[model samples]
Target: MVVAVLLGSVRSDRVGERVAKWVIAELESRGHEAVLVDPMTLKLPLLDRMWKEVKNEKGSEHAELKAKLQPLAELYQRADGFAIVTAEYNHSAPPALVNLIDYFLEEYFYRPSAIVCYSATPFGGVRAAVQLRSLLAEVGMGSIPTLQPVPAAGDALSAEGVPLTQQLAEKSGKFFDEFEWYMRALAAERKRGTPTGTAA
Candidate 1:
């Protein structure tokens, strides 16, 4: 399956990049195609209008907005699943990540997503993951049951973006197993034109 690994932070010293790299490597190692989607690089402008409004507007009236969002929409549409690497900011997710998720609704519909939540503290950004579950659900995306939480993320990864310990590596493996199962199941369901909520 083609999975999109989202680097959900844009801070100068963000550790989410390292987490995202590790996720991509894991997915590739398992023979899955992984694409990196960085909100920082995408640089999507803050949402000024709701998606429904843009859809209802005339072509010329929303041309600029369409241009900015088309690439992102296409990427998400092609992805069978997603792995969002996020950090908790003030007990919530970063606004940039939220903005990226808000850019398209239909692209995320019926797709499955996994969460890799990391933080400097022991909680490992679980709050952000919890909030993201709700947001992704609203967009008709199902989340894998196993959430990968890396506490003290800066220490959990090596400078080369590899897992620093066997325990961490094992946790990642289990998470990927669950993620892949959902990805394949949902991808098949989507292909067979089966209804969204009918899958196991």
Candidate 2:
């Protein structure tokens, strides 16, 4: 399956990149295509209007925005699932991740999302993951029950996303297995048929 790994943090010295890199590598190792959607590089503007709303507006001003967003729309639409790597901010999910996801709705329909939350503390960004469940579900990529939390992310993985400990690698194996199962299952179901309101 083609999975988009949405990196949630854009902070200058953020550790989320390391976590996301590891996730991408894992997905690839499992024979899945992984696309890294880093918010810093994506540089999507703060959501004033969704892509669905913007695409229908007729004007030169909207044309430029449409050109910029067209590739992203294609990528999201083609993805079979998403793995959202998020950080905690004041006991909630980061705004950058939310803004990146809010740009499109139908692109996410009938897909599964996996929450991989991380934090500097041992608590492991569980709060942010909890908050994301509702948002992801509303967007139509309902999250799986398993939440992969990377505690003390910097220490857990190297800057290049190589796991420093056997425990982390082992845990990730189980997480990826569950995520892949959902991805395949949902992809099959989507092929069979989606609900009446599903996207074409």
Candidate 3:
């Protein structure tokens, strides 16, 4: 399966990139194709309207908006599943991540997403993960039950983006196992044209 590892933080000196690199390596080791999708690279504008709304509008402005969003749309369409690497900002997800998510709808339909939450604090961005779960569900992606929370993430990872200890490795392994299962199952179901009741 093709999984998109979404780096959800775009702040300067953000550590989410380290977590995303680790996730990509883990997924690739399991024989899955993983793509790194950093919002910083995408540079999507803050969302003000849905695609449908833009399409309905009869003006060059709407056309321009569609053109701008095309790359993001195509990228998301290629992925069978997602690994969302997030950091907590005020007990919630970063505004940029939410904006990126809100830009597309059908691309997320019936897909499975795994939340990888990290933090410098002890709670490990679990609060942000909780909020993201509901947001992803609204976008039609089924979130896997197993969450990968990297507590004291800065200390947990090496400079090379590798997990530093055996304990962290074991925990990440379990998370990957569960995520892969859901990814394959959901991708198969989608391919079979199963009526998931969540398609847009």
TM-score of 2: 0.95
Steric collisions counted per model: 0, 0, 0
- lDDT by residue (1-200, candidate 3, tens digit) is 88878788998888888888888889999998898877798777788897656755777866777876766677678788989999999999999888878877888887899999999999999999998999999998868998889988888887667998676887577788888888778777776675755332
Error of 3 at 192 (Å): 2.1
Tens-digit lDDT track of model 1 for 12-41: 999888888888889999999899889888
Q: Evaluated with lDDT, which candidate comes out highest?
A: 2
Residue pairs of candidate 1 with colliding backbone atoms: none
Per-residue lDDT tens digits of candidate 2, residues 1-200? 89999999999999999999999999999899999988898777898988999887888877766887788789888898999999999989999999999988989998899999999999899999999999999989999999999999999999999999777888677788889999889888877787865543
Off by over 4 Å in 3: 52-68, 196-200
Work out how many backbone clashes candidate 3 has. 0
Task: Point to the candidate with the largest TM-score.
Answer: 2
Candidate 1: TM-score? 0.88
Q: TM-scores of all models?
A: 0.88, 0.95, 0.89
lDDT of 3 at 84: 91
How do all the candidates rank in terms of lDDT, highest first? 2, 3, 1
Looking at model 3, residue 107 earns an lDDT score of 85
Local distance difference test scores for all models: 0.83, 0.90, 0.84
